[model samples]
Target: MGESGTGEARPPSQMIDERIRELGDWRGDVLSQIRALIRQADPAVIEEWKWRGVPVWSRGGIICTGETYKSIVKMTFARGAALQDPSGLFNASLDGNTRRAIDIHEGEAIHPEALKALIRAAVDLNMSRTRR
Candidate 1:
């Protein structure tokens, strides 16, 4: 378990405490914005630890995740390559073989509308996959 700056403790494996501790002011602001986008998109989507340091959102299968690196905050979708990205918000170069990402550079504002659309698309896609 890890202790937050305020001394509240949480499970070590969850790593929410560690992540909060590691995020300095600016990064925390970025993370909060991303988190708000996800929540607004799907109020029912649950948050969980996935792929070690990433924050994952899902209803059935994985939906999306947010990670903070040295230069940017990366929000990745699990089946992003399969999602229709009409807005071209996701960047292919930053994606893994099965996932795609939107990289928000430092000091840049997150596109909340675009993010909500992506999250809704991802949830619909996952629901379709489960039905088949």
Candidate 2:
């Protein structure tokens, strides 16, 4: 068997790049920044396309999803409720039982290092769950 032996498959990272380029808006830039930070946080992170088009990043399990809407770019953490957020970066979907999201508006300032820490925490949380 060869690399294409499986089927006609476009790489997940390329799909995500297309999605970002398709936006052609501030959301695209924000999502790109978030994506970069995720990679910086975990160089081994896996990018995935799921739920009909959403961009998801995973390590041991799903770490987060990048969902862009008209007004905001949302980064939703899968095990956010179980992780510690001392910097209070999570500003959306806070009431949820499991997921937590950070909504990035056009003018809002994003803390790159803080966000990276959060990403690492999500990865750690996912790893802990998988081990147990």
Candidate 3:
């Protein structure tokens, strides 16, 4: 839980909603779309706010984090290096051994099916790790 502007403790989901509304621009729209896509991909995914208000989606473990900057919306996939991204959605953080990311700028379009496949793969990888 994080404190709101009024200093009240709030759940992560509520905090996420506020963060989206607070953006009030293309970044907000992008974040909102990403959130919906993540939910559609994994209905059991959990929403979390971490490291000072970043939105994280997880199932067995973290699927991705939705982070916003002034010029781009970044979705950093945890354990992304382990997932097979056949559609080539990962354009950022490719240098890392254990993580990958997709950076979306204004007017950029995300391939929904491809992103969903990537997310499902992440979930599968997480579950496999959990069972091990």
RMSD of 1: 3.8
Residue-by-residue lDDT tens digits, candidate 3, 1-132: 487579888888898999999999999999999999989988999999999989999988888999999999999999999888889999999999999999999999989999989998999999898998
Give the Cα error of residue 51 in candidate 2, in Å: 0.8
> Can you give the TM-score per candidate against the true fold?
0.80, 0.92, 0.94
lDDT, model 1: 0.77
* Per-residue alpha-carbon lDDT of candidate 2 for residues 59-98, written as tens digits (9 for 90 to 100): 9999999999999999999989988999999998889899
What overall lDDT goes with each candidate model? 0.77, 0.91, 0.93
Q: Residue 40 in model 3: shift from native, Å?
A: 0.5
**Which regions of candidate 1 are displaced past 4 Å?**
1-18, 94-97
User: If both were scored by lDDT, which would come out higher, candidate 1 or candidate 2?
Assistant: 2
Model 2 earns a TM-score of 0.92
lDDT of 3: 0.93
Summarize candidate 1's per-residue lDDT along 1-132 as a digit string, tens digits.
345578985543357445756786677688777777788998988877756567778867989777888888787788888888888898744446678988888787777898899999999999898899
Better of 1 and 3 by TM-score: 3
